[model samples]
Target: MIYADDSGHPASGLVLYGWIEFSPDHWAPVLKSWLDLRKRLWRDYGIPVTQELHATQFVNGRGRISQRIPPRFIHRGVEYWKDFGREVAVQCLETLRSTEGLTVGAVWRRRSPAELAQTKSEAYSALIRRFEDELAEADSLALVFMDGDGSDSSYRKSHRSLKLAQRRVIEDAIHLDSRSSQLIQMADLVAWCANSSVDRHPGNHFASEWYSTFLAERDPCRSPREI
Candidate 1:
């Protein structure tokens, strides 16, 4: 199955879509490793192992990030979130690099204000083609799990638009609550860091190297595609 997520916004000049793929035989072991990472996060920050690690919110110091470790306690500054966010996110991603059964892929594109919607559509379609090619090469079928509750029609259409004889994604995307799925949350991290690699920002300058540093080893693209 593939656990997918996206980052960036229409207001931003760059947007990204990312997913982590693994086979059914390895699913249990893969999930165990992911949960193991959450355990480590809980140990380090006193954050609940089950808490949704929404990359944007978690990094911005929003939500109950931890119980014993206060976000502000990490640093005494208005931007403590950004500082500690870089630290925790980097640690988690580096750890994820060793997850045994996953392959990563992502595609991003830069767009002007007027072109954001159209460019996003094109980029996602390009990623869908990549997914199709991979499944075809392996002669396998896979389900796509995205971070939402099945409300996104664009993704459904992307899968459905594939030539009927050629489409490999099983039915429509199976959306789930990201809060309950650690895999999807990791995909969220993938998306965010992929965006930072291209669209550098003052707030997330610390993530500038995260994509090349952590995720590149697993992605055949080496760097994410610039569609």
Candidate 2:
């Protein structure tokens, strides 16, 4: 299975997370659709693929120097982002709805008073439990990814637990001579890409989010160079 997730620190709002899942066969078309939208956006704006653009700047701060654009631009941009996400989500859902040869799951965590009160590790532990439950009944190969806030040192503290969970989930697969599951931390790449925002080619928010889930599900076996 293929999994993707996104993370965001909403201005004056909660930290948020979202994820989607799909099987190998469904990956091509869905990825194509997402790419198509990106291409259209680039073409319309004469944006270059090698560069990126920040969402805030794309709307020109809504006619203000430092403030966000007016509601019209904000609304349009948000709608575009949401529509891009929904299209991929719907495709994934369609493939997994029957659960015939594949099972998929996604989760979202929004920071709340209770969550903030807990230690960062504690909050991550809770999120891990939800992830574990999602794949508990699966018999096929499993892959998991998660988007993380690179700034949260406390969150990274949960890496130990995440590692243990990965081992447990794929132990059976290993015993049967199958590939073991893997986990990855994709925040660095996401952060780099986000910071690289150029003109017109808005930041790849979907890729940033997907990196998390991808890192979470990759095989653990790797060489030092690979890391």
Candidate 3:
């Protein structure tokens, strides 16, 4: 199966969609490793594994980690922990690189929501085409998983129709909560990092590294046209 997630607000200047594709054979090992990484976050950094692997929250130091900081250092502490959190994300991504039977892809564009919506069909066509290409190379009929809450119904219907029309390329598209799956979380990480790469204001140097790392190994599915 392929787990997918998106990063950046549609209204933002940059938006990214990322996915991790792996076969049934490798799913267990990858998932187990991810779970182990969560444990390591607690053991190594005292960060709870139960906390969602949310990029924005980690960057902003909001949610669970906020309560753990002392009032005196809350501001600086959050910044410090945010860096640590980003490091953990980078480490997790690096580990996933070594796993067999996995390929990652991202499609990003620098355009506002209005511009994208103006040509949504064309964008979907390019993305679906690139996904099918990956499936073809893998020789696998996979289900594409993403968060239903993040997907618009009309867009989902249109995407479904497109995939179904292609015949055996994708088995189906499944939507589940990102919190429910570690793989989905990983997808989120990729999306988040990729967005950071292009976000000049964020000042995250690792974002470009992470973005290049994922794209280096696979053919990225870009918008306006497949690449």
Using all chains and alpha carbons, the TM-scores for the candidates as numbered come to 0.90, 0.41, 0.77
In candidate 1, the residue pairs with backbone N, CA or C atoms under 3 Å apart (3 or more residues apart, or in different chains) clash, namely: none
- Tens-digit lDDT track of model 3 for 1-227: 77877665566645567677777788998788777877776776566766777777775444354324334444643446655556666667766666666677666655666776634444544566666775678665767788556456544654567645554445445777766677888888766766666564546664656666644454344211122
Q: Model 2's lDDT to the true fold?
A: 0.34
Residues 192-212 of candidate 1: C-alpha lDDT, one tens digit per residue: 878778778787787788889
Off by over 4 Å in 3: 66-79, 116-122, 137-139, 163-165, 169-172, 213-215, 218-227
**Residue 195 deviation, candidate 1, in Å?**
0.6
Q: Among all windows of ten consecutive residues in candidate 3, which has the lowest summed lDDT?
A: 218-227
In terms of TM-score, how similar is model 1 to the real structure? 0.90
The backbone clash count of each candidate, in order, is 0, 22, 0
TM-score rank order: 1, 3, 2
Return the lDDT, model 1, position 59.
71
What C-alpha lDDT, on a 0 to 100 scale, does residue 164 get in candidate 3?
57
lDDT order of candidates, best first?
1, 3, 2
